[model samples]
Target: MTDTVLVTYGTTNGSTAQIAEAVADILRKDGLTVESRPARSVTGVAPYGAVVVGGALYAGRWHKDARRFVRRHRVELAERPVWFFSSGPLDASAAERDIPPVRGVQRTMVRLDVREHVTFGGRLEEGAKGRMAGMILRSGKGGDFRDFGAIEAWAHRIAEALAHT
Candidate 1:
């Protein structure tokens, strides 16, 4: 029987949600029963055979709900296969390539023994149009720098790892 997988994500400007959906799709194709839900919507982790948690980075912080979910479910999560992903960075500029402050949460999760964590560049959507975004965009500073090929390859790797466990 296929294992149940839960992909819970927190998104502010929408890129993280899209990335989570892509990961879920890849898991489903691998014959896992997958459900993609917003982080706030998640009630419990017990139903899932494996959990994949993801969040967006904003101003050097992860979405609050993502942090809470992990904190609340840390014990259950530690007993199972878990993976983490963060959707951040806009392009190949020095700022994007450099580690952002919001990345610290991944290290915290690693301490809890999450099996894997991956970072991927996010998108700049309409709602993300803010003073900072505008300044960045006006400066012609960033572009949609997400690497779909790499994302897919990572998803495949996650699937392969899960299959063996």
Candidate 2:
């Protein structure tokens, strides 16, 4: 496989997309060719040597697009290195500890023999889409809780792992 990596994500208010871009940036800096794209827009995974798929959480489940991306590309992904991340939890919990992957993500990881998985803090702010987002904002729970330092560190780990492979 070539040293090309695909970083893709499913996002609601665009926060998860930002996280994916950050990961792609780090991978690129590590001298890997990287491509960042929305999960819904990717048609195939065959061209990538490695893949990082991230999803935004909503009510304890992954975004529809991320779930669909995994399901559709399961075959191709199994043949290469794959990592998964979830961005949700508008709190500092993710930064403070190792947030375990939800059931669906866990199952996918096991089935695909995924390299690793992580749960990063999420972001919710004004102008977010969806009724639940508006409700959360009204309840004063909306905020940016993503920790870029942790995200970059994780990407560095991925880059290191890629180097050995």
Candidate 3:
């Protein structure tokens, strides 16, 4: 069986992509083959033994491309091990907020029997384009808040799970 794992993500300003790459790197370090791609660019999932899908969160919802990817691949994903992640939350406190998964994602999770969903802290660059994001950035709260240690720990856990599977 192919041991390749697919790490795909959706991002508006690239923070989510960075997180996805970090996860992929950790998995690769554990001796697994990893392929990383943007959600919209991924054509199929059959070649992968496991799938890790991630997206940037906005207004309590996942990026549209990521959501669409889940909807399109729910069946194949159900047949394999699947994990989901959202990259949002401006700070540690935001990361601790008890935000519920968006309805679409929740439905997809049930359909795919997803193993886990992790939400990581996000970054907001000052010159980001969106009006809402721009306004938030003006408030001087925007900066990289990603917890790399936590992200690596989660990836290691995934690697362990894959080893047993």
Candidate 4:
């Protein structure tokens, strides 16, 4: 509870990482200390006052690393404010509507009492790994659909909530 926030994510092609960075940057600009890192790399959550976990959606589920992170830190995370995000839906749908978290993610949210959960548009670019990604690209279904404005706005809300707390 030192007013430091940890923004961590599991990304397959790096888009989720970028979103985490954006969230961390906004928190920093709002006068809070923040760290952004990969979900699997974090050893513990003892040093953070709040946590933001994000994952890339794949085949209707959250990234495995993200799920593992939550399971590993559930005890510590339950004592602090926590937020979750999922980056998927390679369309504008995420931006146009509030996409509910996948079933597993929803379960985690309830278990952790997460402050909020968001579903952001995902990015599948030309060099994304995996045969499915290549197929999506060839089928012309890959593109960047994340809305920075919405992301910043969400981060700002987090900052505001933290300040009040």
By lDDT, is 1 or 4 better? Answer: 4
Off by over 4 Å in 3: 94-100
TM-score of each predicted structure versus truth = 0.86, 0.98, 0.93, 0.98
Kindly report which residue pairs in candidate 3 clash with one another.
Answer: none
Q: Give all candidate RMSDs, comma-separated.
A: 2.8, 0.9, 1.7, 0.9
lDDT score of residue 153 within candidate 4: 96
- lDDT per residue for candidate 2 within 5-108, as digits (tens), equals 99999998999999999999998888889999999999999889999999999999999999999999999999999999999998889999998999999999
Model 3 lDDT per residue over 1-165, tens place: 338999999899999999999999999999999999999999999999999999899888899989988888878989999998888888885456645566777788888899988888889987776998988898887999898988899899999999999
- How much is the lDDT of residue 40 in candidate 4? 96
Candidate 2 vs candidate 3: the lDDT winner is: 2
Clashes of each: 0, 0, 0, 0
Residue 64, candidate 4: Cα error in Å is 1.0
**Alpha-carbon error at 123 in model 4, in Å?**
0.6
Backbone clashes counted, model 1: 0
lDDT agreement with native, every candidate: 0.78, 0.94, 0.88, 0.94
Across 1-165, the per-residue lDDT of candidate 1 in tens digits comes to 427989998887677888888898998888778999999989899998889889877777777778888888888888888888877777754224544335568666666787777778877844465687777776766567677776788788888888887
Give the runs in model 2 whose Cα sits over 4 Å from its true position.
none
Residue 132 alpha-carbon offset, candidate 2, angstroms: 0.5
Candidate 4 off by > 4 Å? none
